[model samples]
Target: MNITDLMWKNATAYGYTFTRTPPDAACAARVTLLEWLDAGRINPAVARVFPLEQAAEAQRHLIEDRPFGRVLLTLAR
Candidate 1:
């Protein structure tokens, strides 16, 4: 399926607008998105963190719906 079809499917399933097309004003939109993120207005739940090497395992956990929030992959410094 193409991007449009995929978007339609998702929108129908979730009852929301899913756009396959890119925004015409991406630069301005990106600035807005960044501002929201920095302002804590777009905070996402963090379920768990794993080392980069365990990313695959984390994905599996997410796929199984074991995580309650977003899973993050961290790199050891």
Candidate 2:
């Protein structure tokens, strides 16, 4: 098995065109995202939330090819 062997494995890239979209449309999408999070539609994929300094730890894990999903790094509160 090789990297190129998985070409298009993730399918098409998707994203929001906030900069190009009208302000109202962009705002609506943002609101929708917030609502989804509030309603538990969006949840953390990782077991732990890493503090900012843990960024280096996260990088090492990623570089070492450790299992991961959404790695959330938090700011000081």
Candidate 3:
């Protein structure tokens, strides 16, 4: 199936479940992520840390759909 067909199927199956977010909703999402991180609700097993210099490489890995969880860039030590 093509992109449009996939999107229509998803929409029909999960009516109104996907939509653009307002500014406030975006802020709320950021806050929720921060809270989850602070509360240690996010599992380390699902996280990958990389140095700033390797950010491009990280993006390539993600775009290629390499195996892993969240990819993060960190400051140099």
State which candidate has the highest TM-score.
Answer: 2
Q: Model 3, 20-52: lDDT tens per residue?
A: 778788778878878998899965554567799
Q: Could you tell me the lDDT of residue 13 within candidate 2?
A: 44
- For candidate 2, lDDT tens digit of each residue in 1-77? 24564565854544567899899998999899899989999874674567898999877766675655666689999
Give me candidate 2's TM-score against the actual structure.
0.55
The Cα local distance difference test for each model comes to 0.76, 0.74, 0.72
In angstroms, give how far residue 43 of model 2 lies from its true place: 2.8
lDDT of 1 by residue, 1-77 (tens): 25698786775433322264367666566677789999988876799988999999998989987767789999899
Ranking by TM-score: 2, 1, 3
Give stretches of model 2 more than 4 Å off.
Answer: 1-20
| Model 1 regions more than 4 Å off | 1-19
Question: Which candidate ranks first by lDDT, i.e. highest?
Answer: 1
User: What shift in Å separates residue 70 of candidate 3 from its native position after superposition?
Assistant: 2.0
For candidate 1, list the clashing residue pairs, or say none: none
